[model samples]
Target chain A: MAEGTTDVPIAGYSAPRPRAHGSALHRMARRRSTTALLMCVPLFALLAGFVVYPFFYSIYLSTLNRDMTRFIGLFNYQYLLSSNTFHLVIFQSCLFAITAVFLKALIGFILAHVMHNITGPDQKLWRGVLLLPWVIPPALSTLGWWWMIEGSYSAVNWLLQQVGIHPIAFLSSTAWARFWIIMVNVWFGTPFFMIMYLATLKSVPDQLYEAAAIDGATGWQKIRFISFPMLKNIISITTLFSLIVTFANFDIVQILTAGAPANTTHVFATYAFQVGINSGNIPMGSAVSLFMFPILAVFAIFILRGVTRRTREAI
Target chain B: MSSATLAAGAAAPRRGRRPSIARERRWALWTSYIALAIFAVGFLIPPYFELVTSLKTSQEIGAGTDPWFTQHLFFGNYTSIIHNPQFQIFFLNSVKLTIVVVCVTMVISVLAAYALARMRFFGSQMFATGVFLTYLVPESLLFIPLFKELANLHLINNTWALAFVWPTLSVPFCTWILIGYFGSIPKELDEAAMIDGASHLQMLWKIFIPVAMPGIIAATIFAFTVCWGDFLYPLAFLFTSKQMVLTAGIVSTLIHGDVLDWGHIMAANILASAPPILIYAFLMDYYIAGLTAGATKG
Candidate 1:
């Protein structure tokens, strides 16, 4: 290591001089930092060109009319606001997100608690099993579910028949389609919540439980007062994350129903795709997609702020 | 043993908590087991049914054969797909695309992540936040304008066009993971090497990269999986069968206007899904830890 060569005043007072005039480590640091920066520039440029530019480009696109030459500022917005289909889609998107998020959180929390109560060996096995839905790629796994719910050869329908109930057309009927998609979304997502909650569960110190036990606290009491409070931040962040993703979900809705049954199941993304990419009406599609950004941005910002605040509090 | 057990039981309820607590524990245990069993079955049944269906013959499947039982083990479906040109082309295209995209993604991510994490510069925080937030931009919304951009660039039918595009989606998540991991490493290690007069490039290669292998692995897996499983991008970008990736190729060629070719379709789907599934099955701990690190460690 370099030390003590020439006397020189450093930041404030006189300090021992560095050992070597030009050190290999200093040269390495200089070279690597430059290399690292040089390496990063292209990626930053790529993101700027593709992601950042397209984001702003959509804003410009949203203002134009169908021909792409003429400007119709807010006309697409006016069309969206006035249309009955747009109104229905907005309502349905919320219904899909809110309902699925709530169910997933509740079920996930309970499942986590139950798993927490289980002993060694079994806990490890169950944890792996529970996370299977999340492990499989969403598109592929949802395709599997899609084939299962196919109207002609429906497995759930066959099961319903055995139970003396009429077979429901899960995908064909608008309401049933909405319900099943949300159910599948919940199923796919709850494991994420479970894992997060389980991790949080493990972090809650054993001493709190021991203290509660000393005070004659029941299991419910221990959980309600201790576990719930400890997990508030995670709960909020996870829920917010889930809400944005679910609201913007295109795959499940597209693959499951493709906005069929008179397009009753269409969320903003698929609906935008239908009007925009599928039909070549870029302006209208841009407007619809632009509408989704603000919602997601707001959710993301709020969640990030919450996370940072919690992090600050923790520190 | 019996006398000892009776004596111990007589002493156990002295505080009167044993019997009731035992009952409550039993109830909780039973309830937990039952709920877990129901959920386990619920999660298992659909995929299980799909597997069963995939193994059945087309005639058996169409004849309303009991999904639970197969008339005969038909490995012929799998064999026929292997012989099909379309299937083979799609498979090869997917492999080529996944490999190229992953390589490009890793390169961009490693360079960008190192800069964002270790470099002292203006706008690094803003850039990092922007990177993380980009992951939140679901591909659906972005694909519209991006599709037009490709059209303008004359890259719509290009298979390797994904080498340019896939990084946009992969880099943000991968870089964030890398930055988070790198940030957690102590600065003193770098400083000590600097004191010894080692070059920064050498230090990074010789020290930081090895120390952060898990992060690199996590990022690579994420990058590969996202590229491999991508549907919308491939669909929007590539139109011709020759240019198509496995996902779009299989759906287009097999489904063919809703006259579903179940045999070849199932075979192709199984083949397409096998890689990522195998990766996850073997490296679940890494995947889970990586995702958690991305999600909560941020």
Candidate 2:
């Protein structure tokens, strides 16, 4: 794309007086670069101040002691490494992120295919309804989940009782809390995956599917051969994106469990807040949060590779 | 029949095969409707139930009476929440912060997106990728350091703190979406403007901005929703009742320790989510377009 744009100006300039055009082109290039730099000033400044600077600062903070008065290199890491709560948080965070991402991706893929199979106004209406979970704020939506699952006014339990079953404690127990946390994460995130996959599904040209049908391909076979391969890039990118966000998730877990029932439900973000802010162990919290960095870095690299590869294929 | 005869018979009269195919399609369609209905009901029930619960009396809610419906209508939950001074502060704070952050994000994003999409400069590709990387850098990772950074700047507990911090979340994705939007415009339009000696700024202001209004609107909606819904940042930075935004404020204040107010809490949730929900209702297409474009295109 950049080559095509640059070619246009050069082709136009080639017809003009050669010597004059050369200097003019150089001047134009200089002017264009200046404009680009000037245009990017605000963004660079904002990223620098908020994103880049804070990122490095977090690394710095993680090295410091609890109060951050003195640098205690690797002490926070050493302490967190051996701590059982931090270990549980690591286990829980991985379990929550992976399970939620997998469930969301699977549910979203099925929902998108369902939406695709339906037609017209029905599809539009269902799409809108399905997106409600994603549209609402996580903090707010999780409150509704909390209310439904809370022991005092347990709506789900009430229904279970109606069915002549025992009312289970949803959030009061460790396993139940973790179960609800992942459930809520899947609920909130599936719509995003659905919308993304739906868009990708739309872009899969009808000709491919028609050709498949002509060859006597089954619905499952069409999806396997045509849909999955076509959607591989998008699926990976969205899953990785969700994985990173879920791995560092704070809102759903915090609002629902707040790492309750013995902190079995704590992920990196919630645990970081608990240790850093609530406990006033800033360095430890920073360390806890930074634990997400290496995993996310790996995911980020994979997503970037997928994005660039897809773009290259498109080109 | 023999296989050749069966094939010949199948090919001879397409009309004869129509009813069975139609029947199969009808069955498939009915099955899809059932599946979709079940999925939609499951998805919508929680929020719908919250809405219902919010409209019920506290006594009814506490009694766990009819989790699906209420006998008596009650406006007290909504009224009490709206009338509460603290809740009002949370609402106003959210509004103020969302507006400021959205404006800042759109400006920064538009300028950056324009540069990256239209201008050929050194390191532009790297910078564009950097923006995406920054977007992926979750606030959970940065909040601890940001807390210290804001403290050093004395911006903690100040609502304006978010105005500075939220762009880290909003700008990268907004810029990415806008880049896709801007890139989609035919190059000739901008190239023609350039040949006519239109400056880059004028071209951006007059041509790109006008043609890319949909994308800009999409980005604006995205930025607005993100700013409105963000939890981790405000949760970390703003501690005071006066400082808190709607999400953190309502959660912190309403659901005190062990004593839970189901009606008021649900009402607060509905109220807090109202802005984004209303926006999504009106601009659903733009919201989804921006999101998909950002995810798929980038």
Q: For this target, which candidate reaches the highest TM-score against the unseen true structure?
A: 2
Question: How high is the lDDT of residue A51 in model 1?
Answer: 89
Can you write out model 2's per-residue Cα lDDT over B151-261, one digit (the tens) per residue? Answer: 999999999999999888889999998888888888888778877888878988999899999889998998888888888888888888999999888888777736577
- In model 2 chain B, the worst 10-residue window by lDDT is B15-24
Q: Candidate 1 DockQ category?
A: acceptable
Chain B TM per candidate, please? 0.88, 0.91
Mind sharing the TM-score for model 1?
0.90
Residue pairs whose backbone atoms clash in candidate 1: A3-A19, A24-B197, A24-B198, A25-B197, A25-B198, A28-B199, A28-B200, A29-B200
Candidate 2 docking category? medium
Give the TM-score (0 to 1) of chain B in model 2: 0.91
Candidate 1, A246-276: lDDT as tens digits: 8988778877887888878899988988888
Show where candidate 2 strays beyond 4 Å: A1-18, B1-20, B257-259
